[model samples]
Target: MPSAAGTLDWLPLADHLDLVAAPVASAAALVPRARVARIDAGLADTAAFCAAYDVAPGASANCVVVAGRRGGATTYAAVLVLATTRADVNGVVRTELDARKCSFAAHDDAVGLTGMEFGGITPVGLPEGWPVLVDEAVVAAGDVVVGSGLRSSKLLLPAADLLRLPGARALALSRPA
Candidate 1:
């Protein structure tokens, strides 16, 4: 673990956490003693991050933001998938959100809501009422690498505990990528 006074420049995960809402502290307060890792490599892509970090495919989780549209308004919901698969976003998310149209939010749009850079956003500190869909594969993984509320770090936690966050819900709603 880096020191409390460690430098966060070039560290998206660490820098964002320090600048954004109390995401890390909130997790610790709720889950008790959670530790986040600051990695030197970019975790922007599931495949690349796993290969660079030597993390097994089954151990990685892909966090995605999907735009939910009803009439002319759009809202965003989060979907968590096993890195080995893609979120069945079109099928499950559209239906779940009651959206007439749905698609992935642009990188900039996602970062705005998350206050974290791309590849490192987590559902932990998102606005309440934004649904979080967790693929069953992630639930069964036991542990996962989720965003540290920042772009350069990852929160390592038991998968079950991730579901305890305010809006997290485990669902069997993704297909192999």
Candidate 2:
């Protein structure tokens, strides 16, 4: 990892599966360039993590789970956007999912469905077939910090690498908030 990567001693994400959620560990192992590091659970949120770690907001991304429901069918997807902005959830995201209404997934629903902690859910390792809506700016960012599916750890990798995961699509997904 680069020395500019704040204070975290990033190492191969695959070697520290125990520090991440189960699904993250499984999917991360395939991304050879990805790295992981431990952090105080209290600093898991984007603002705290960036402040304490000296990471730029532009270099940090947040993953949010959104639910789109129409009739009795519901679709879930993960949205990734730079911390400097916010996902256009009610606009682009809802249209992207092709649902009549959309909103942030309920806390219990997000955690239970993904098997990841509330503040640590990541776009990586999501259930199969769920689209990972990555903001265009995020993919263009060379290096970015992301959740590890565990509040105690974080993932570091080229933001573009996120596109390698299944069902990833680069779009104008966010705007300054």
Candidate 3:
């Protein structure tokens, strides 16, 4: 596939991915079809990544980790939303998680739990039992781009394929920015 930087060497998601992102590769394999591409690690953040790679914002998905507490127990979830919108962390997400209050997970915690870089967490390789709450719009966006758990690559797959991930579920979890 071609990108702003020239031709993108799209490969199976399982190949040429970092070992830390193995879970993402494993989950991606479960999908009927998935592809990945290497990119400059410095451009891993959404805006830079899209611009540097010639990807439309709408075609890029961002996965954010949220955390909250209820009944003295902490709960966490990975929320997937398009770059064009913002995840409703305090509203729909909190309600869905049955949390009294919710907020984006701290940098260290998110990286520690998922073993993914700060700007490269993806729903594909989240901790077991953590909900992968995808915004409804994301699933309807056709094939979308997402982080590869490491900052060195990104995955491309149908939005619906994300919903098929082990703990993934679609919800009205985002609002336009």
In candidate 2, list every pair of residues with a backbone clash: none
Q: All models: lDDT? A: 0.70, 0.89, 0.83
| TM-score of every candidate relative to the true structure | 0.82, 0.96, 0.91
- Model number with the top lDDT: 2
Better of 1 and 3 by TM-score: 3
Q: Give the candidate order by descending lDDT.
A: 2, 3, 1
Tens-digit lDDT string for candidate 3 (31-63): 657777888889889888887778878888899
Best by TM-score: 2
With a 3 Å backbone cut-off (N, CA, C), the pairs that clash in candidate 3 are none
The backbone clash count of each candidate, in order, is 6, 0, 0
**Model 1 per-residue lDDT tens digits across residues 83-176:** 7788877788889889988999998998887776677778777766788888888989876766666655666656787788777888888888
Give the total clashing residue pairs for model 2.
0
If both were scored by TM-score, which would come out higher, candidate 2 or candidate 3?
2
Model 2 weakest 10-residue run by lDDT? 1-10
Clashing pairs in 1: 12-151, 12-152, 13-150, 13-151, 13-152, 13-153
What global local distance difference test value does model 3 have? 0.83
